[model samples]
Target: MLKHTDIWRAIDRLAAQHGFSASGLARRAGLDPTTFNKSKRTTSDGKLRWPSTESISKVLDATGASLSEFVTLVGDGTGTNPLQRVPVIGYAQAGSAGYFDDAGFPAGSGWDELLFPSLGDPHAYALEISGDSMEPVYRDGDTIIVSPAAQIRRNDRVVVRTRGGEVMAKQLIRETATKIELLSINHAHPDRSIPLSDVAWMARIIWASQ
Candidate 1:
């Protein structure tokens, strides 16, 4: 269960990590300066007040932080972890051979490294978006973090590799024993339904540096 204090503390730590005070974070998120003030955390009657989901969303977007990263902060509330160096590759290049292992985990050469907060997934890697196929949500040149270890569910944004060597990012629509359905991020692109046998591997996209 998520504790009220933990969530508030996470917000404070997130602000501090980005070199901002609580009020500054609120302002950066386009909220009133007092939105995250300590005094506002509780009512005059001492009733606990939780942050609104919209406020949290705005802060995350403003900070370029992932939901997973905020959840980690909720647990640790410590921004002490050192930046991690993770493998990175171009989205288009990911379709080429020798880049990923059979399970879709990054492998072989031609991968560069990037320093980012540890996402706690050993198989996590970054992909630089190349074309407008995923536009609006993930523009060209955006960096997206993918984790093969993360659990995939309906509607989760994911990176998928096919046995035929096609790699693409899309939202998972449905999956079953025989097929996987994907909804394109850009409406201009057509949604896809691939046989399970054609899918070499699929991984959930955990974060993106927009």
Candidate 2:
């Protein structure tokens, strides 16, 4: 039996693979941004609101993705397609309060998930880099896996959380008794220096897909 919920989930997955939000995909398809939004799936009366064929055709045209691709994206076998699955959250929302708990596990809202090919690390979580700020080293769409419990050392690629709840990924340069210096992968980005006391936690980067 074909499930509407399953199709909805597949739409989300396909959007992520193309590095787009559901709204973003809708706009590209010349439809309203809410076309694929979660709220639009079922109404208050419990009636399913399937996407229109016109909207679907528009999406196909905009994405240049074929019907077979759409089927593969939503098919039952898709999850087993040799990709290492990791919990993914957007970098922009990662720094917000409560996004991660005191123990560094993902917490309250403003996050979405995705699966990627597995790296050897078992404790990996993917963070989508948002801007060109990381540039040559990490592009805007690049997704990086960070292991919170992994051993962190000077000169390692790391994801750092500040006392103020900001999260950033950089190359550790020098760790002194009082402060830590981090090198930005992009020459255009300035290096950062933070007092040891202001760092909440630091995690090691296990893998990254640019």
Candidate 3:
């Protein structure tokens, strides 16, 4: 029998493959952004929550993915190449101490897990968007996959953390030996230029559910 986690993992992978987070997938399907969030996977009383067939049907319409394809994603997911199972957390909690190592990998507990098509990254993790700080592009409740081990490049989407424990997801504009420039994904937030010394670490955002 297909477990609840297995079904959810398939939905997450499906969203990721189509450049969406679970919330984005929900939005695309005309559902509330939080419909697919991990926090909704269970009830306040601790009972398992399953995705409604209506929501799943909406997602299928939005992604143009057949039920068979979703089934393929939910299967062993270990055929020719094994899927990479990545840890996940909400972006609001990303700056909390002990959730990440000095190198920016998921370290402590409080993380959920999801399977993704191989990205060859052992340090890859997902962060769920919490607010509209990155609106238009990344709205509230969208999820993004970050690869700490991946190369940081100009013009790439990135997640940057400051020594002060601030975490931001933005577009990389320029990076020099002394400082880096970043463009805001949300137009309302002005661009930023911070000294390299102020940065704890910067990781490339390989994928996002938009």
lDDT of each: 0.85, 0.74, 0.82
TM-score of 1: 0.71
Q: Candidates 1 and 2: which is better by lDDT? A: 1
- For every model shown, the clashing-pair count is 0, 3, 2
lDDT of 1 at 135: 82
- Candidate that would win on TM-score: 1
Please report, as a residue range, the 10-residue window in candidate 2 with the lowest summed lDDT.
75-84
Clash pairs (backbone) in predicted model 2: 84-116, 84-117, 84-118
Which parts of model 2 are misplaced by more than 4 Å? Answer: 1-85, 108-111, 116-123
lDDT by residue for model 3 (149-187), tens: 788778999999888889999999999989999999999
Model 3 has a clash total of 2
lDDT for 182 in candidate 2 is: 97
Query: TM-scores of the models, in the given order?
Result: 0.71, 0.55, 0.66
Model 1, which residues run further than 4 Å from truth? 1-20, 28-83
- Residue 58 C-alpha lDDT in model 1: 89
Worst 10 residues of 1 by lDDT: 75-84
Best by lDDT: 1
